[model samples]
Target: MLLEKINGPDDIKKLEISQLQTLADETRSALINKLSKAGGHQGPNLGVVELTVAIHYVFDSPKDKIVFDVSHQCYPHKILTGRKKAYLDEAHFHDVTGFTNPNESEHDMFIVGHTSTTVSLALGLAKGRDLNGRSENVIALIGDGSLSGGEALEALDYAGEYDRNLIIIVNDNDQSIAENHGGLYKTLKKLRETNGNAEDNLFRAMGLDYRYLEAGHDTAKLVELFESVKNIDHPIVLHIHTTKGKGLPYAEKDRERWHAGGPFNIEDGSPLYPYQGEENVIFSCLKELLDTNKNAIVLNAATPMGLGFVQGVREEYVKRGQFIDVGIAEENAVAMTSGIAKNGGTAVFGTFAPFFQRTYDQMSHDVCLNDSPATFLIMSPGVFGSDSNTHLALCDIQMFAHIPNLIYLAPSSNEEFVQMFRYATTQKQHPVAIRVVNTLRTTGVDDNTDYSVLKSKIEQSGSKIALIAVSGLLTMALEVAEKVKEQTGNDITVINPRFVSGVDEELLVSLKKDHRFVITIEDGELMGGYGQNIAAFYGDSDMRVRCYGISKAFHTEFKAEELLDQHGISVEKLTKEIIAALRSE
Candidate 1:
């Protein structure tokens, strides 16, 4: 195969111009071959196959570094740069990560996952090369969708003024995770329609020289484009138009559906392994909330699909001015929610917990400080969320709970999540942020607990041992309590702290009366989490407090159950530890 012939950047550089297109073909085949079974950013990687080949064929990587924006398009780049085994062979499918990593290969520059960071990171590389008095072509390969980010805009502006060798490759596939948004995309569309000869070009207006190629999939043309601008004296924008999900028919027709997902059938693009869980509890509840509350507005930053607003359902709310997509900018969505609430409109903003990390300042200053009563649904937090350290939101509690005027609620079950979501949206007293239920288990009964007054629910009362489990860990706590009862015939008090932000001081103080031994368990990190607060409250008390949670570290690629067991949050481990603690006394 032509792909096998080319092992590294050197091999690609030695390849004849005629053989380059064949290599691009094999690279795309390899991308599809693995992605169909392993599943990843299928459309983004497939769209960039020819582009990836062209860059490696022209420029010397490691010397002339190219940084992929979100690293979603790096799969083709990986296949070309000596990592083809992971894609071409199913046995090695679990080898490489879905994103870029410097540790994996010298060819890979940074460990990137989030969007719109390439320009700034590439600028730093260029600046470093200049500082060391070394001359190397530093290239930033960003998507047209990433142009909406403030970092990309700021770096692009600075690049126009910096007199250095920087190449900005704008891979325009005309799609973000969903369809592209904002005023700039319209200008990009104009440029695409006009064959890049449009007047008042955005890049040119930013004082950067520009060139465009409508044939982004053509290997020969792409190589020629890169060769024409190699070692340029100033920064230039190479705008290349390509089709997202290029090789697949259904994927090309529906780009958003093919953007990223689980393993799928190569024949009809049907999911090989689909989610077998019941209908999402949060999505259904949110739909009900919108159906009833006319003034309520739900907002998300680019990831509307993940948060349960799919096309037909989303369009209905959009037409009603009840749902808005802020387009890959979380900071704006958060502050806007606060403004909407201040003006008498009911506002709720939700995004992935990892993405919400960027809005800490906005959530604190604009929303909480003003006490706007905006509701935020922090989705998939703690160990249950994304395992990537870049996207892991284990430290979410440290960011939120300490902030004044913000009430952060954590729900244990489906019913609890529904009730909490209702309370957060209805209450006008403080800014509320609810950590959405990660576990799919339901407690069966309707949750009638009053959240207006912050408190804990004690399921079973007992002396000597008290278990304070936070949110999703409530299930684990109950099992541990049952295990203790089965072993010692002593009922262990199980307390469910629905609200994670504050300690129910009255309830906590009352626990000290009967509970000689207190064990706190949470799904996130032990430090600055819900458990630690309980430990701190009992620091001076006669009660012995032991907080159980994952260590304060950047944990990645771990199974949910395995991570819980490692932290001694599992029923068996907790039961054994409790029995030992009791024996010591």
Candidate 2:
């Protein structure tokens, strides 16, 4: 096989121009063959096979660095860069990551998983190269969807002025995880329609030379384009239009659904494990809010589907101007939500917890400082969220908890989430952030707790020992209480601290009257987490405090249960520890 013979970019360069297309076809086949079972970014990777092959064939990789924005499209790049076995061999499927890693290969310039970072990163490489008197070409490959991000636009504005050998390849698949948004996308559509002859060119306006290639999948033409800009003195933007999910018929027809998913049937594109059509609680709450309140709106950066606002379900609300997708711009989304709230409109912005890292500055300055009553839902935080080191949001509490004028609520059950959501939207006092659990634990009852008064609820009352469970770990806390009761004939107190931002001074002081041991178990980082607040609250008291949480580290590819167990958060371990503490006293 052509792919088997190919080991690296050097091997691809050894092949004749006529054989490059054959190699690209092989690379795509290998990528599909693996992802059909393992599942990953199918559409992005499938679309970039030819472009990656052409880039590798024309440019000297390790010397001439190539940075892939988001790196979701780097599977084809990985297959050609001495990592084909990970795609071709089933046993080796677990060998490589879905994104580019500098640790994995020298061909990979950065370990990037976030979007809209390539241009800036490539600019740094170019600047360093110039400073060191090196002349290696620095290339940045970014998708059209990522172009909507503030960072990419800022970098593009600067790259236009930098006089150096830098190549910017705009892979215009015309889609983000969903359909593209923003006025920039309209400019892109115009450029594509006119075949880059339009007078209103975003790239040229930035002061950079531009070229257009319509046949993006044609390996030879892509190679020609790359060759022309190989060692150019000035920075250039190569705008190439390509189809997302190029070779797969099903993926091509439904681009959004094929962005990323689990293993599927290759023949009919049926999921291997069919979706059970579970109720999306988040979307149901949003629908209820929008249906009742005309002034209420929901906003997401680029991940509309993350809040369960899929293509079919979101269109009607979007038409009503109640649903807004800012398109890969989380910073802008946060600031806009603050504005929406200040103007007496109910605004809720949510995305994956990791993505919230980008909006810390805006969340602090624009939202919290202004005390805008904007509701922000932090989705899938702690050990249960995205397990990649690049995407681990173990610091959500650290980022949001201590911010003044912000009330951060951690709901342990579905009913509580609903209650918190209602309270957050209706209240006009402080900015609210709800840390949504990955799995919804149903209580089958309504939560009518008056959150205006910050307090802790004692789920079960006992003497001597108290367990303060944070959000998702409440279930484990209950189990530990049960085990301790059965084993030691003592019922341990279980406290659910609904609020993370502030300690319930009344409730905490009440605990010190009867409770000797206050153990806080959280699902995030041990340092600067919810547990630490409890520890700090009792620093000068007779009450002994112990905080259990995941250690400070970029932990990845781990089972939530196992990671918790390592932190002594398991029912068996905690029960024994509590029993021992009880016995010692």
Find the 10 residues in a row with the least total lDDT in model 1. 435-444
lDDT of 1 by residue, 1-585 (tens): 888877788999888889888898888899989988888888888899899999998899888888999899999989888899999999998788888888888998998888889999999999999999988899899993888877798898898898888999999999888777778898999999999999959999999999999999999999999999999888999999999998999989988889989889989999999889788777897788889989989998888887789766798998999989878888889999999999988888998999888898999999998999999999999888888876888888888999999999888888888888888888889999988747746878999877888888997888788998887888888888889888988888899888888888988888778678899988888888888888888888787889988898878778888998988888888899888877777
Off by over 4 Å in 2: none
Which candidate number would show the highest lDDT if scored against the true structure?
A: 2
Clashing pairs in 1: none
Q: What is the lDDT of candidate 1?
A: 0.88
Give lDDT: candidate 2, residue 104: 94
Quickly count the clashes in candidate 1.
0
Q: How close is candidate 2 to the true structure, as a TM-score?
A: 0.99
